[model samples]
Target: MDFDEYVAARGQALERFAYVLTGDAHRAQDLTQTALLKAYRHWRRVTAAEHPDAYVRRIVTRSYVDWRRRGSSREEPVDVVPDLPEEGASADPAERVAARDELRRALVTLSPKQRAVLVLRDYEGYDDAAIAATLDCAEASVRSHASRGLARLRAVLSEPTVPEELR
Candidate 1:
């Protein structure tokens, strides 16, 4: 497919990947824009790449890691906080909010490499080899990261919950 067509088709998916990486809508947008702009400049080479989408994702992930290393604030800027209530009436909204906040905090605690590996492997549905190729690491490294990342996530998930049983 042509560059324009490819962009139209994959843009949202790319943005979602960035969002998962940064956990902020605005940062995700910025990361997507920066990655896309860089990709556009090297369109010829990127288009010829085996998986251009993966290539762009790598750029986004790398950019986020670099940005974080520069001592930039990780908190997502928000204009207004949404006050949506919990889904089921059986659950207390406050408890749900607390759980969500815990998850977000846990996600932020992960190293950029660990977060990238977990997001790509578990969230993006990528295989070990695909993640290794995208991250330009050995497959064994991917396996190790994914294993450690998942273990950490599981530990976080198992922590005490506001609703007690929700833990």
Candidate 2:
């Protein structure tokens, strides 16, 4: 596919992937835009690859990792937390949002590389080999990062919840 077609097809998916990586919708949008711009700038190089979408995603992931490492000194604290929307009520929206928030917090606890590996492996449903190819790391390293990342997530998620009576 041509660059335009690729962008139209993959933009939303790339946005969601960025959201999962950054855990903030605004930052996710920025990350997606940055990745797309970079891809567009090097469209020839990217489109020549066997899996161009994968290549762009790798760019997004690495860019995020690098930004995190370099921009740590300018971080700002969140002054307020937003409330969850009530759109999906099958499960309590509040609880679901809380769970999502916990997951986001757990994600921050991981190294950027580890977070990227988990997001690609579990959230994006890429296999270890695919992840290794995308991240340009060994498959075993993907496995190790995924393992450690998942253990951290479980630990963060399994902490005390509101009492059953409250729910």
Candidate 3:
């Protein structure tokens, strides 16, 4: 497919990927825009690749990692969650949102590269080799990141709901 068509088809997904990486809607949009602009310059090369989406996703992932390394995009995580709409007075939706938020919060504790590795491997179901290629790292590094990331996430998520200070 052509560049325009590719963007049309994958734009939202790409933005969502960035959102997962950055945890901020505005930053996600910026990251997606940057990746797409870069891809547009080499549209022919990108589209000619066997998995063009993966190619563009690599752009987004690498940009995110690089941005994190540079300590740019100083967006802070939101401390307050907006009220969710009540679904027929059921609390299930709220619970799910809480879980998702908890996971997002837990994810932020990971280093950017580790977060990228986990998101690509677990969230996106990419294999280690693919993640290595996407992150421009070795497969062993991918495995190390994924292992440490998961461990960190578990530790963060398993903490008591009541803060130790509260306790």
Order of quality (TM-score):
3, 2, 1
Tens digits of per-residue lDDT for model 3 on 39-72?
9999989988899999999999999999899876
Which window of 10 residues has the lowest lDDT sum in candidate 1?
A: 77-86
What are the TM-scores, per candidate, against the unseen true structure? 0.74, 0.75, 0.82
Could you tell me the TM-score of candidate 1? 0.74
Instruction: Give all candidate RMSDs, comma-separated.
Output: 6.6, 6.1, 5.2
Could you tell me how far off, in angstroms, the CA of residue 145 lies in candidate 2 after the best superposition? 0.9
Candidate 1's residue-wise lDDT over 37-155, tens digit each? Answer: 99989998888989888888888878987887787746743222233234573298677877566566667656677888888887888898888877789999988887887777657
Superposed model 3: Cα runs more than 4 Å off: 73-97, 161-167
Q: Who wins the TM-score comparison?
A: 3
Q: Please give, for residues 68-121, the per-residue lDDT of candidate 2 as tens digits.
A: 888661224332223333456528867786757745655666777788998887
Give all candidates' CA lDDT scores.
0.77, 0.78, 0.83
- lDDT for 138 in candidate 2 is 96
Candidate topping lDDT: 3
Clashing pairs in 2: none
Evaluation by TM-score, superior candidate among 1 and 3:
3
Q: Quote the positional error of residue 167 for candidate 2 in Å.
A: 24
